[model samples]
Target chain A: MESKIRVLVGKPGLDGHDRGAKVVARAFRDAGMEVIYSGLHRTPEEIARMAVDEDVAVVALSILSGAHGSLVPAVIEGLRQDGADDVLVLVGGIIPKADVPALEQAGVSRVFGPGTPLETIVAYTKSHVRRR
Target chain B: MDERYLTLSGIPIKNCYRPDDTRQLDYARDLADPGNYPFTRGIHRDMYRGRRWTMRQFSGFATAQESNERYRYLLKQGQTGLSVAFDMPTIMGYDSDHPKARSEVGLLGVAIDSLADMEILFSQIPLDEVSTSMTINAPAAVLLAMYIAVGEKQGVASQRLAGTIQNDILKEYIAQNSYIFPPEPSLRIITDILSYCAKEVPRWNTISISGYHIREAGSTAVQELAFTLADGMAYVEAGIARGLAVDDFAPRLSFFFNAHNDLFEEVAKYRAARRIWARVMKEKYGAKDPRSWRLRFHTQTAGCSLTAQQPENNIVRTTVQALAAVLGGTQSLHTNSMDEAWALPGEKAVTIALRTQQILAEESGVAQAADPLGGSYLVEALTDEMERLAQEYFDKIDRLGGVVSAIEKGFFQQEIADASYHYQNRVDKDEYVVVGVNRYQMEENVEIPLLSVGQESVRQQWKRLERVRSERDGQEVRRMLEDLKECAQSDANLMPVILDAVRSFATLGEIMGTLRSVFGEYREPARF
Candidate 1:
């Protein structure tokens, strides 16, 4: 029997738009991954702390408030400070194309924009997550 | 390829619709003349002929001063009313300088920390001359108190003020998730506002029971209508339990809905909403006044419908959706900007969005008569079908011991998730075509300049907040907050005490913090 991959879906910052987060979380669940949803209004530190505590292989942070430039990197930094650097971080929501490379340089493994297929996210997670 | 034809709500659409399709719908009963009982055609008899719908643009970003400039610009451009959008921190009941509000201050909307900020927001605009709509929940009472304070400063009595507070917290639970306190306390606060506004702010819309966020959360049209109306019913029940008469508050009750892509489906949804509310209010709640049954709503173009691939296409999409709202007989409409898919709308983009409504009202002949598409075979059948589907949902909700219990059981969330998943599957399979998204591929760079809130604005906001805190009388602020906490503890209405707190220059976070001590915070149960 194959071990299920674990993923934590976090909504960082004060943005209340959660439809994308909820939808992606469900997609992960349906794809047979162990999914933990961090509810709304979570700070970057709280999300990173949850990721480290849960021992999840991947943490996907969703934001729509265009504060992604600041919030996403903070999440990455928080994870690094906690020494959970191997947790593949994926950013999703309404990210502009120009910000993709900056987010990648900031340590995000992948950035998914609006209208990206859920299957693509699941596939990316399955292939990229490092096994401990 | 196998044949596929269905509405976003999963209703099977026939190959063609004709008179036979609407044979079961009674003209006098279900399809009565405009402004009559069971107002399927429209709530107003003259509709746009009497007066065009209010072109209320929802605009706010950065600091209060900057947002005020934008509002003044919009009003100068022939915009009819003001709709204020507070920043995330303000909406979540946090002061601008709070640690949790870092990187989020003035990012999405204006950061209003105290009455001073609200005063700046409406600085030059007279409260008596203009109507304002605020999109703030969880801290709606605090925001309303600030608005009333601003009104009093302008020498406008509370009874003379006209505007709305999107104080629909139940939808916050069901869809938006911007709630602070738990469900029971939240409902109590909502009822308190309804009761107080019945006497104090008679012209003010106490609650804009919203389906807009529900639909934006990916619920089907039918689910949006059903869940929203269910939440509305919950508010009415809470008000009645508080010993307030239905007619007193119900007449001031209003609704907010989404205007999505589908033309006929969106129009039919609005018509069905009015009919169902009329029947339910008259039959179940025994609302005597005809005004109590009317479902006046504000429509906003669907933000989710906009695509980033070819942002220009969004203009056409918004125009179509705006037309649907006008034809659907919306009392007010907010057309979304084309560049919203990337960032908050810039000045040029927002102007075009508002102009879309202007062109539709001034040029397009669609609003020449009430219910322009009233007798269309397709529209009437769809309207009847929408009502039937919503009724089925109401029955299921009733069986689950009503909306509050159903929310506890994750009923509404599950339904929305299932519907969203189904729609996404269709898009993935190319069964449902969204131009510039799943099809009509484009390979060009997005060159539009996006709106960016600077760190200077955040710094300025924090400085102002600190100054306000230092200047205000500490003893008075403490006393007012204590009085507010006492009101929260007892069965008394909370609006007056909250007003006093605002008048004393208490910050939004201080008042909400006091209530949190008594009511506690809410954490939504994970369903996925």
Candidate 2:
């Protein structure tokens, strides 16, 4: 029996643009990963709670509201405080290039922006999960 | 690779289109002359020949004072009209000082907390001299009321105001998830706006039935048209059910569409939309006034199509999309800035975007003719096919008990998700070509100076919000909010009370909270 990789895809804050989040979630499902989608307007605490509750290997945060600077750190901290620090965090959506380094420093393993191929994201997730 | 040909909507395209392809299309009934019934050629006979479409660039960011400066600058730079973009907090009906709004205040767009913010937003710009379009929903009534109050303060009569409020909430459920109220009460607020604007603000376009967000959400051109028109039908039905005459409110109805990369398909989509809307308004609803049937729409270049890699290529992409919009006969067009894929556009990039429209309208002779691609065999065939596919979708939506019910059942959401996934899959497989991304790869670093909203603006906005709260009459605000909550409990039009609240300087969050107490919040059902 194969062990399936579980991932929780979350949208935090007030950003309603979810095309990227939904597409990535579908890609994960097609890649044979068990995916849980945290629907729109979720707070960081709620997303982190769902990540712990789902006991997922990966927690992907998607936000296009430009609030990622503040929200992404909060989510990462929430996960750390909730003792889910082992879960890998990934970020995507309309994040600026300048902000990517700060987000990485805050513990986002990867930041995918517009025009990023889903295969790249899938491959990155698989490799990171395997290493973990 | 096998040679496959199809529109983005998955409609197979022939190698060559001939007269036989459109044999079923009657010129008199289907492809009538421009500005006539069942307007397929174009909505206006003169089209751009008489007056070019309004070059209204959607611009807003940081504080209202900064956004107002940008608006004034754009007007000085030859922008014909103003289209305001609100931040996520404003769009979600949260006050700037709210904890949930912290970090999001004026991030994506300007944050408006109350009538004070709206006044600052329109300062120095004479309301009667210019038109404004606000991209707001959920709390659209509150924003529109604020606009009306601003106009009154500027000494402009309500009847003299000419602009549009993107009051289309159905698409919020379908594509954008920024909705505040549930479906039933959302439609009621929309109908109330339609009724109120028809009687009081006679010149105002109450709602802009939008397909822009639908396309941005990854739906195909055909789905954008189909879902948007279906939503428009639902609004009309709601208004008629509320005892308002169809013609009374239909004339103020407008549309908004997206101009994607496929120029021919996009032109065909616009043409088919006008034809179908004209037919629906006349044949189905029995609208006698021609203005009611004329499907005037605003177009914005597709933001999803813009690329972060070799961002300069986005200018060319925006130009192509803007040309398609002009060729398709958009009443107004907004060209997306190149830097948008990364962050809010800087000054230089936004100016170039405005220039893209000006060059298309002035230098390029594409706007001289009405529907330049009207009689082309391929365009005509594509137009007919788009109409047929959209009609099929309309029938399916009708069978599911109309747009609102279909939304509740997650029909539109599922379809968009499927389409978006398919598109992404193609890109992943290298089946689709996105220049500078999957193809023509580059290793050069992006060197554009991205615009960053400073923390000072957020602090200032918070301070301003606190000042408004302290300065406003507390008694009047409380009384008006009470009245608004009471009105929300009943079927009485909430617009009047909402306007009263706006006039009393009730904050957006306060007003939305009152209504939320009555209408309750909406929780979207699981899609997948």
Candidate 3:
């Protein structure tokens, strides 16, 4: 597929603060990836549907409202429902370190926290995104 | 040769700022009286002298009943007012049962779908007696309508309602992006409410024009002020376009600002914001109402400044920011819990956050006088510099057409990106110290408890939403939605129609989805 590297970044629950997510989207776009930024209050289903329709290679979920344990799995399930299991699921924003393993088990490929560098994210995306 | 001594926002501090530094500031002409024109010193003459700023803590949780209990608990703890933070589903205009709302019905903020939820959220809380501020926008009109519906049921006259809605949606495009309608239509909805509230809910604050989120998004104080005022100007223009007099609605217009770690810069920013807003409302919008010119704002301690490494330090960070907000003369405030960097604040942590405010109000003598830091040469100089920097940004944004155009061109996003990058680079290079995060590393096991909302909240909310959906009148909902779609397509404002939908138990998702079909989703510009 000769297209922009589409990534869908969303906030699954009521966490209205999107500073980190918006900054990440800008970082991705600056690194030459086609970013599809979903505004706040997105459900896992809406996000998965968007990822499918946009044919995004990566889905970055940002939840700061501390609803991640519930919302992260829902996003994974939604992706499965949309036949988007191949999409790399990356979760970030206020996630406790202890929840990382469970999130990984729930199909979140990677978890980034407050101190994660944007360059590291860009590097990871570039190396991991499967180019057609 | 050392730029290391600068303030957090990179404002260089001098060894001493004498009278020469503030010679340009004509206190009588530029700043004027504290409670008078410009309101640079303070909005009221007595300020904290007469009454302490309202300790309004933002509280909400899964389910309206649970949230109400929490609100009552906070009130019992000496909280002066109520600030409601709705859940993701509600903020995004989705009902609890919407497919998108599956696990998120009431996860973050309170889930409010109809008048029932609204009533439950405020149950036993006297609507007429206590002021409530709701942090909602995009569907603010719908939420306001639901609030009014609840008030009507309580036999409280609309005129008796005194509250504020975070109805500033322009920042949604800039930083948040939880907006439902397009910019133009969203502005229309905001104006419609402004016009309606001026007559009906006379004491209600129609919009809390904000710069809190902007500063949180990594912008400096100057950028926060510039972008925020530009958005406010857009709203003034929007109200004027609706054929409403500026003075009629501007008085009800309030502001919400973020108090960041930079104490002096944050204080100066607040002072600059007041003077600039007063001048603009008077000279630009031709407003005669003094209330219209005064920029009354609510301040929340910055959540971004909290470090996850040494979580305990957040208390200190919040105290500094909260004191700055008090010195800046905010009308009300919310201090972030220490564990905010970990997860949702638990009862214990939230208590401390509330106590932080209480201690400041009762113990600290900072609230003794209005704008105690008013005559400081350093603060005055910084205020002037901030104003000048902000005006430069305003001129640039105006040339790019307005806030909407700036968003379309990714102007604000790009600025935030650069600032975030700069801050991050400094952190990575050990140039900026974030205590335990990058410096003063401590090798120790975690001692503090991490607060989690738990899985039971999800299951319970899911069940409640399902019950509401199945039990509601389906036919009435369908009819109401059809009416809403019609109103959306027509020249009629969508507030009344949205109210009908909410009243008929139409879900948030259905309403927002209808508007999405009309406006289409916004595609953010490539800023990198």
lDDT string, candidate 2, B289-363, tens digits: 999999999999999999889999999999999988988999999999999888899999999999999898889
Give the runs in model 3 whose Cα sits over 4 Å from its true position. A1-18, A21-61, A65-67, A70-90, A107-110, A117-132, B447-451, B454-456, B466-476, B517-520, B526-528
Query: Per-residue CA lDDT of candidate 1, range B254-326, in tens?
Result: 9999999988899999999999999999999999999999999999999989988789999999999999999
What's the true lDDT of residue B336 in model 1?
98
Q: Would you list the C-alpha lDDT of every candidate in the order shown?
A: 0.92, 0.91, 0.84
Query: Candidate 1, which segments miss by more than 4 Å at Cα?
Result: B1-3
- Pitting candidate 1 against candidate 3, the one with the higher lDDT is 1
Lowest lDDT 10-residue stretch of candidate 3 chain B: B519-528
Better of 1 and 3 by DockQ: 1
Give the per-residue lDDT digits (tens) of candidate 3, residues A24-109: 88788877888988765666778888888888999998887666888889888998998878888898898878888999999888
Candidate 1 pairs with clashing backbones = none
- Per-prediction DockQ comes to 0.77, 0.79, 0.41
Q: What DockQ number belongs to candidate 3? A: 0.41
TM-score of each: 0.98, 0.98, 0.90
The residue-by-residue lDDT of candidate 3 on B1-528, one tens digit each, is 366878777878898989999988787878876798888998898888777899999988777888999999999988989999888778877777766665666667788867777888899998998999999988788889888878888999888999999999998888766766678878877888988888889999999988888888788778888988899999999899889998889899888999998899999999999999999998988998888899999999998888877777899999999999999999999999988777678888899999999898889888997898888999999999899999999999989998899898889978976787677778867888888878887885545676545457667666766777889999999998888878777767677787778777677677777877776655555443
